[model samples]
Target: MSLLISFSHLISRTFLLDFLYLFSVQIAQQVKLNKEFFSLDPATGLDGKIYGLPLYGGTDALFYNPKLFEEAGLDPNKPPKTWAELQEYAKKLTKPEKGQYGMGIYGKTVHAVRIMHYMSNAGANGDILRLNRKKNNSWDILVNSPASLKAWQYLRKFVDDKSIPPNTVELTYPDLISLFAQGKVAMLTTGPWGIATIKAANPNIEFRVALHPTPDGKPPKLRTAPLITVISKRSKNPNEAYTFLKYLTIQIGAEMAGKGYGVLTQTAANTPQVKNNPMMKVFADQQKYAYFSAQELLLAEWLKCKDQAWGPAWEGMLMGSVSPKEAVNQAAKRIKEILGDKGNLIYPVK
Candidate 1:
C-alpha cells in the first residue's frame, strides 16, 4: 500500500501546480485536479492534466448598509449597479461631519483586491495580467492601459472627495468590516465571507449585497478565489483515491453549503435549495462572470509583487503622493521586473 498525498484545502491549485512543475517525476507525475468546477474561468489551468480537487469559492460583491441608504434617500433595495450611480450614492451617503463615510476603502495588501476586482468589473480585464494566445501561454500586463488608469482614477476620486474613510490606505480585511458593521461606512466591496463577519460583529445591523458595480451599462464581470484539492500522482491507489476525492468535494461539499459554506460544484450551486437562499443565490448567479486571477496559477512571485509592488503604489496614489497614471506606471514597471520574460508589458515601463 503506497502513500497517497492529498492536497485538500491546505494549498491552492497554483501552489500544487508549482510543486508539480518544479518536482515532476521526482515527486509527482499526473495529479487529479477538478478543473470542471471552475468553468467560469476557462483559463484556470493552462498546463492541462494537472493536480487537485476543489473546495469552497468566494467572490467580491457590493455590500451596503440598507439603513444608510434610507437615511440618504437612496433606494435601499436597489444598490448602485453602475460606477456613475455609485459616485452619486456616495456623494449623498457621505456625511463626514457626522462621522459617516460613503465607502470603506481597503488599500492594504490582502484587501486591496477589492478595488482591483471592481476595476476588472469596469472592463480592465484583470488590469495587470491578461491571457493572449499569441503569447504562447504567457500573460501580458495592462496596468498602464487607459481602462486601468480610469479605474484607479475613480478610486482616487473616492479618496479625494472624502467619500471614503480617512486614511483608507491603512484599512484591511476585518478592519473595514468592523467599520461597516459599526455604521461608519455606507458601502463596501466585499464577499460572502464579509457577510458572516459583519453579522458576527453586529447582529442587529441591516445590510445587503449586490453584484459588483460596473462603469459600462452592462452587467459586471465577477472575480473569485476558490480553495482546490488535488491528488498527488505518487498515490498507488489512484482509482480509490479519486472516489474519496469526489465524495469530499461533491457529496459532502453540498451538505456543507447549507451552513453558508462555499460550494464549487455548479450543480450544488444551482440546486433548488441553494437558489432559494438569497445569499447563495447571489453568488451562484455571479459565478457566470467570476474568474480566477492569473496570480492563482501563474507564478507565486505575483503574490509578493502585489504586496511589495502594487500595494504601496496604490496607497501612494490614494494619499496624493503620486498621480494615478504615475502610480500605475510604476506598478507596471515593478510587475514586469518581477515577472521578467514571462510577462510582457503592454505599455512601455517608463
Candidate 2:
C-alpha cells in the first residue's frame, strides 16, 4: 500500500471526504502538536475527529536590512515596534536619489493577505473577515470596521509619502523579495522562508528579522498558513502511513526547520537549528500570537471576493482613485453580495 503525500491547495470538503481518512484517536494522542494547526484542518465539519497533521508552513514577520538601518543612523538592533516608529524609520531609510525605497508594499492582485496583517496589527484581531465562533461560526464582514479603516489609511501614507516603490501596485511577492535581496528596499514584511531566499539571492546581504509592529507596540496577532499531511482513504495500509507521517513530523521536524522549512512543533523550534538562527527564531517566536485566518472556512468565496471585490478596492485606494473609507465600503458591499446566505454577515454601522 503506497502512502500518498499531497502539498496542493485543493483541500476542499469533497477532497477531504473522497480522499482522506480521519487519524485514529490513539495515533493523535501519541504525539504532541500545536493546537492552532487543528483549526486549519479541512475536516472541520467532522466533529472532534482529527484528519490531518500539520507539518510546516510560513508565519508573517518583519524582515529588515541591518546595513540600511545603520546607513540611516537608526539602531541596527532596534527594529520598529509600532506603526509610528515604522513610518519614522521608513522615512529615514528612504534614499530616493539612490533608487532605494524605505519599504516594500504589496499592491498586487493577492495583496489582501498582507493588508490583513496590517488590519491585525491595528486591533482587528488578525482577521478582516472574522469567524464569530460564538455565533455558531458565522462570518463577520469587518472589512469596513474601524480597525480595518485605520489599517488601509496607514498603508496609504506609505504611498503618499513616496516611501515605497513607484510600481508598488504591480509588484508581486517575488518582486518584493528580489527588491529586498538587492538592498533596494530597507524593510519588508514576509515569512521565515525569506531567510533562505534572501541569502540565495545575495549571500553577502546583512539582514535581521523582527515581530510585526503593532499600533501600540504590543505583541500582535498575525496570520499563518500551515501545511498539513493527511492519509489517503484509498491506502491499504493505514498503520504504515501513520508511522511514516509520525517519523516525518516528529522525529525529523527539527532537521526540516534547519533547512529553512517551517517549524511545526515546539520541540523543533527549541532546537539549536531554529533557536540559534536569528531570522528563524523571530518567526518561531511569532507563532505564539499567530492564527489561521477565518477566511479559510470559505476559501473559494474569499478568493472570488479578492478577485472581484476587495482586491480592486484596495488597489484603487492605494492608487489615489478612491478614499480608504469608500474602498472599504465598496469591498464590503460586493463581498456581502458574493457571500450571500453562506455565512452570517455583519455590516459596518452606517
Candidate 3:
C-alpha cells in the first residue's frame, strides 16, 4: 500500500508537468507575432474595426559599393544623377580580367521585372507581362514616349561596355544579390530583402542604400513591389486576420521600418523613426516621387517594345543601329507580336 501510494503520486506529478508544458507551448504558438489582432479584423463587416490602407513596406533605396567607388576615385556620397553619369561611373568601376563588374542588374531576363520598378522613374513604363494588372501598374505611363527610348539606350552602355559579368545573361535575383554583396559588382539597385540579407552576410562592407539614380537629372517616378497583408477568403478566422493585419500594419507592424524590416508604404513618411533616419528618409521622400507602373490589359506588351527597341535600338542608333524613327518603328512591330501572343493586340499596324 505504501509503494502503491508513492507510485501514484509520482504519476500525478508527471502528468501535471506534462500538461503545463503543453499549455505553455500552445500559448506561445497562439501569440506568434501578429496573431493577437485577428479578433479585431473585419470579419463581421464592422467599420469600427476596419479601415482602408494602401500597400506598404514593399521596397528600399539601393546603392553602390562605396569602397569600390572610393578605389575608383569616385565620391560615394555623390552617386550618378543621370543615366549618362551612371554609365560613366560604371566604366570607371569596371575591372574585368580579375572578374570584377561595375553594375549588378537584371540583364536579359524574361518577365521584364527590372524596368517595372526602376525603369519607370526615367519616365518609362516597363511592365510588359500584365499591364495595369494591379492597382498600380503605372510602370508604362510613358512606354510610347521618347524618354522611354532614352532610358533603354542608357542601359545598353553597360552592355556596350560589358560592365557586368558575362554570366549576367543567366543571373537571377539571388545570383545578382549574392554577387553584389561580395563586392563583385560596383552598383546595384534593390530594396529591403537585399538590405536585410546583405547586412547579415557582409555587415561591414562599405555600402549604403540610396535612391536609384535617374537618367533625367531627378529620381524616377517611384514604384516598388509591395509586401501586402491580405485576409484570406477561406480563412476560418478572417476577422482574426483583419484584426491582426490592422494592428500589424497600422500599429506594431509599422515598427518594421525602424528595425529595418518592412517598408511601411502608407505611414512611412509620418513615422518618427522613418523621418529621423537618413537611410529611411530617402525612401520616404522618394515616395512622393513614385507612382505605380502601367495598368491595363496588354500593358506589358507595349513595355517590351519600349525596352528592346530603346536600349540596343536607341544606343545603336546613337551609336548607329538604325535611325531613331526606324528603331521606334521596329519596337512598335515587336510590341505587336507580344500583344498578339496574349490575344490583346496593341499595335493596329496589322
Candidate 4:
C-alpha cells in the first residue's frame, strides 16, 4: 500500500511536468504573438521559453485637444513633431487666467514609470537600460546618461514656464486624465486606456492622437505594459486551460479593442473592429515602436527602487528642490545598490 501511494504521487508530478512542457511548445507552434510583447522571466533570466501570452498591451502617445490648438493660434492638424515644438505649443496653449495649462506632467505616486517614458524617448540609444551585446549580454544602466539629463532639463522648462498645472506634483496619470477631460489641460502623453476614460468623462471634448515627440524629431521609443496570461503548473487540465486562454486572448481581446475597452497585442486579432476606431488605429500604429523597459523587465528590483529611490528623486527635480543631475545620480545609486552585481553599470565617462 505504501509503495502504491508513492508511485501515484510520482505519476502525478510527472504528468504536471509533461503538461507544462507541452503547453509551452503548443504556444510557440499555435499562437500568433507580438514579438515585442514576449517577455523574459527576470527571476530565471532569459531561458528562451514562452510562458505567457499577452492578451493586450498599452503604450503612450501624445493626446492633444484640437480645439485647444485652434484657440492657441496653432494649426489643429499639425501637432508638435519634436520636443522643442512641444514646448512651444505648450507655451501657446497655456492660459493662466482661464485655469488652463498647456501640458499635464504626472508627478504624484507611481509617476516614475510615466517619467521613464520620456527618458526612454530621449535615450541616446532609444532605451534607458540596454543589453550590451559585447559584454556577455549584460544590462547597462543609462538612466544618468547625457540624453536622460537632457530629457529631465527639457521637462524642467514646463515648470519654469508654468506651462504645467500648479498642482502638478500633487497629480498622477488619472488626475491628469481628469484634468484633460475637463479641458483644463491642453495636451497629455498617456496610453490608449485614456480614450474611453476621457470620453466617458466628457463626450464633447475634441482630441487627436499623435506619436510621442522625440528630442530631435526622430522616431520615438515609448514604454509598453502588456497584459499577459499564463497557466499554472498545478492546473488539473492543461489543454482546457490553453483553450480558455486562446478564447480570452483572441476573441475577447478583439472584442475589448473593438468596444474601446483596451488594445489587443495580437496583430491577427486586429479585425475591422480595431481598425475602425480612429483612436485605436493610432495606438495600433504606435506598437511598432513600443518596448518594455528594464525596470518592467525586472519587476522585483524595480519595485524596491522605484518608490524608495526614483520617485522621490524625480519629484524633487520636478519641484526644483534638486537638479536633474542630482536626481539621476540619487536614483541610480539606490538602483545599483538594489541590483547589486546583476549587470554592468555603464555611465558615460566624464
Candidate 5:
C-alpha cells in the first residue's frame, strides 16, 4: 500500500515543477515513452526531454440521431461528410415548430474553444492559433485570417438560422450531451466518453459516432486532448513509479481501451476488445490525424487568454454583439496583448 505513483491530470503543468527538469533528463536517459502519435504532438516530452506518458486521449466526433435522420429523409447509415451536407441535414432535420433543433453547438463561453477547434477541422488552419516554426517556434494568433473568419461565419449561420438549440449559447459538453440524450438536439460534437453517457441517459436512443464533417469533403485534421500521467519529481521511489507508469500506459492501457478509454500506444489500440468495439474503432481510426493544442505545452498564460479573451469574443459573436470578423479580430487583439513581444506573429498585424 505504499504510495509508489500518483496520477495527475494535465501533464502540461509539470513544466511548473523545478525539479522535473532534472527528473525528465533522468527518465529520458533510462526509458522511452509510449510513442503512438508522438510525432504529431508538439507537447510531448518536457523541454525536449521525456517526462510523462500519455495515458488516454479524447478527440471530438459527430454523434447524430439515426431516428432523426430517418425522420428527416436522410440515410441513417450515411452521415454527412462535408460542412455543406451537415447544414442541409440540419435544415432538413430541424423542427423548431416542434421544439427540436437539428444541432447543438456551444456558441458562447469557454466551450467556444471546442467549437472553434471543430471548425478548424473544416479548413481553419492557423486561424485561432498556429506554431510559427520559422520564427523560433513562437505561437501565432490567426483569428483574423480568412480561414478563421470562414469557420466562425459558418457558426454564425447556424446560430442565425436556428439550427442550433436555443440553449446552446452557453452550452458546455455536459449540457450538449444532455440535450442530445433528451432528444432536444439531433446532432452534436462529442468524444467517445459521450457515447456511454448518452446511453446511460437514454438507452432507447439510436446514435452513432462519425468523423466530424469537413468543408472540403476530405478527412479533417481535428484537435485531440490526451490524458497524460507524469511522475512526481519529489517521489520517494521514482524508479518504481516509472515502472508502474510504464505498465499502466502500455499494459493496462490496452485493457482500458476495450472499455472505451483512449490509449497512448498502438499496441494497446490493437487489442481484440478495442479493435472489436465499434465506437472505439472510429476513434482509433481517427487517431492518425489527431494533433494536440499548443496551449497544452504553454499552460497557464495561454489558458488565461483562452478564458478571459477568446471566450468572451466567441460569446459576443453568438449573442450578436459583433460580427464574426469583429469577434475574431477582437480575440486576436486581446491574445496579442497577452503574449506581447514573446510570441512572433506569422500573420500580418492589422
Candidate 6:
C-alpha cells in the first residue's frame, strides 16, 4: 500500500512506493549477507530486483472434508475437473434439508470485486482492470479486454444460476464463513486459509483443497493474488526481516512438503528440495503458469480500472442489466482512459 495515496498521507509530499524503495535498496544489501537466497535471481530482471521474492507465490484451492466427499458421493480423492462438476457436487452435498448448504460464497461484498481476478485467470475473457503488458516500464490500465469479459461471465454463473443461495448477496466474509462452518455450503472456491476454519467449525467436516474450477469446457488456469513483503522503511531490524524473508521463501519454502502458508517463492517448481510437502508441492506446480497482476505497479490506475472495468460490467451481466458486449466495451473504455496514449511497448530497459 502506498502511503502517498493514503487519504491521511495525501498532504504528505512523498509517494509511498518511492519512499519504500529507498529502504528496499538498503535491505537488498542486508539480504545479500545471506548467500543461500538464490531461488529468484534478482539479476534476471532488468532492475535486478526480485519484486515477488518477499511475497512468495500464492494459490486458491478447494479445501473440503475428506469425509464429506464420501458422504456426498464425491471422490474427495479425485476432485471435480470443471465448474459444472463442482456445482453438481455442491448441490448434492448441500442439504439445507440436513441443515447444510451446497457451498458458501461471499456475494456482492465490497472486497468481492478484488478477488475476481481468479475468474479472469480461469479463462474469463476480461478483467475490470488490466495492466497492458505490451507497454514499456510505466503502467496503464487495460481493463475490459475480451479476456476479462469472458472471465467475468464465467465466474458469475455460480451466483446467477443460483448454485449459491439467492440471498448470497447478503453474505459477506463473516457470513459466508459461518455458513460454511455449519456445512451449509459443501464446496467453495477458497485458498488454504479455509482449512483451519473448517476444522474449527466441525472438526469432523473433513476437507481437501483443489484448484479453482474452470468455466464450462475451459481449462483450469488459476491466478495467484499479490502479497509482496517489502522491507519496512522504518524497521530497526531490516536485515533480519530481509534475511528471514529470503530464507523463508527460498530455503524453508523449498524444504516444506505442504507448506501451510499461502504460497511458495521457489522458482523451480520441480526441484527435489521443493518436494517437501503436499501443500508446497501444489503451489510449486504453478511456478510455470502463475501470473501476478499486471496492474500491480499502478495501484491507483488499476483500482479505477477495476471499478469501471470488471465491477460495473459484471454487475450488469449478473443483473441482466447489459449484454456481455456492452460490458466489455465499458471496461475497455475505462482502461483506455487510464492508459492514455502509452498503451504500447517502449524501448527496452538498459
Per-residue C-alpha lDDT of model 4 across residues 143-225, encoded as one tens digit per residue? 78777777888889999999999888889777888899999999998777788889988998889988788878877767665
- The alpha-carbon lDDT assigned to residue 66 of candidate 3 equals 84
**How does residue 162 of candidate 4 score in lDDT?**
94
lDDT of each: 0.70, 0.73, 0.52, 0.69, 0.70, 0.52
- Please, what are the lDDT tens digits per residue for candidate 2 over residues 1-350? 33334333443343433344342333455454445332343333233345566676667788999899998899989999999999989988989999899989877847676778889777643345765556664567888888888898998899988999988888888889999999999999877778888888899888899988989899877776666566655567877877887777755766877777776667677889888888778777777777665365334466677778888888888788989899988888887887776555465634
RMSD of each: 4.0, 3.3, 14.7, 7.5, 3.4, 6.9
Clashes of each: 6, 0, 32, 0, 1, 37
**Best candidate per lDDT, number?**
2
Error of 4 at 304 (Å): 2.0
Give lDDT: candidate 6, residue 298. 31
Worst 10 residues of 3 by lDDT: 1-10
Task: Give the clashing pairs for model 4.
Answer: none
lDDT of 3 at 274: 74
Per-candidate TM equals 0.86, 0.86, 0.63, 0.82, 0.86, 0.68
lDDT agreement of model 1 with the native? 0.70
Comparing candidate 2 with candidate 4, which one achieves the higher lDDT? 2
lDDT of 3 by residue, 37-111 (tens): 212222111112222222344444667788898989999888887777878888888998767898876544433
Assess the local accuracy of residue 164 in candidate 6 as a C-alpha lDDT between 0 and 100. Answer: 69
Candidate 5 regions with alpha-carbon error over 4 angstroms = 1-23, 26-50, 122-124, 131-137, 232-240, 348-350
Candidate that beats the other on TM-score, 3 or 5, i.e. the better one: 5
Candidates 2 and 6: which is better by lDDT? 2
Model 5 earns a TM-score of: 0.86
